[model samples]
Target chain A: DAGITQSPRHKVTETGTPVTLRCHQTENHRYMYWYRQDPGHGLRLIHYSYGVKDTDKGEVSDGYSVSRSKTEDFLLTLESATSSQTSVYFCATSITSYNEQFFGPGTRLTVL
Target chain B: AQTVTQSQPEMSVQEAETVTLSCTYDTSESDYYLFWYKQPPSRQMILVIRQEAYKQQNATENRFSVNFQKAAKSFSLKISDSQLGDAAMYFCAYVNFGNEKLTFGTGTRLTIIP
Candidate 1:
């Protein structure tokens, strides 16, 4: 059942606390992405990995960091959580030609 | 950087009626893709339909279809015989041939009236 699994489906943490959201995929697709969805902003890319050990920042990568050590794992870390960073996080994977991204059920994070 | 825009903030349609959601984008690249994604209350982003920029024919999936006006950079979603399940936030997205990141619009909240 690991098409794409995001850990702790929901999380509530205090400001300044370090929090990490994990995205695990069974698919061996080469591209993986992390995005945050908010009310009026829609979904904005945070970071993405083209392959293991290769990563790049998205438009909203200020407070977020991501790592892909293995083909199946992409981890997003909030070094210090902030209330403004609290939003629904989604992980997606895709093949080379088709841009259709399969998104995982989002992880709802709330910062206090 | 490409930008997607969904001008309508919210719209309503009576059950079984048709509704169209508008989306426009700005990009210099000619080869790219457009998409419509539905986010239900559960917050799961589901792909409604997609259109390739090079294609002249619109793409359809069941009750959902897209009207792609490439020259105009307008990609709109038309939901025929709208249902209650269609009530959700619809987002228009764009992805270039080389870039995997999907740029999304602000999204339109569609309400299905009884």
Candidate 2:
């Protein structure tokens, strides 16, 4: 919610295929994050961007890459998605490090 | 490294009853933030409550309140007058000062019985 939108809410893709998930925010939050949710793992951060063209890896950055071309859009790309990458992905935005981060509706990606 | 732990994997509470979900964290930093997020069947992550490490007073929102024991390094969520809508998986998360990245715990699945 909170003016955050994630595209392709549900997608079923084949193994080794490239996939990109988009997150757009109108709130102009200064920070954006990409995370994945698995059954046993609550939510693991894949990557984050503090400003346009400024990105950094997170705890689970392997097999995933991110880019922030504008203040409103953050993209997550899986070069070659594997079955292990199948999970629900969430995008969150925060105005600052101390502010409450707002989350967008999650995107469920299934790799076959 | 900071880690959050939710010991209870599953819990059930009858309608109109109270339920408490426990969460604890391990962190060396004194200044940080704690949060509880709820994910229902719809798969939307909702912020239920939050507590700041420096604040001594517990944070309360409607029927949702938190028991924050900073000395004990514990933060637990209490929900009163539970309803069917309260059935969801709750996650406890932590973030250190100056860092927006969050570390989350394995969730606790809550079931509401009529």
- TM-scores of all models? 0.96, 0.97
DockQ for every model comes to 0.68, 0.75
Error of 1 at A78 (Å): 0.6
Show the colliding residue pairs in model 1. none
- lDDT of residue B17 for candidate 2: 100
Q: Give per-residue CA lDDT, model 2, range A8-90, as digits (tens).
A: 89999999999999999999898999999998889999999999999999999999999999999999999999999999999
Off by over 4 Å in 2: none
* TM-score of candidate 2 against the unseen true structure: 0.97
Residue A60's C-alpha lDDT in candidate 2? 94
- Which candidate gets the maximum lDDT versus the true structure? 2
Relative to the real complex, the DockQ score for model 2 comes to: 0.75
RMSD of each candidate relative to the true structure: 1.4, 1.0
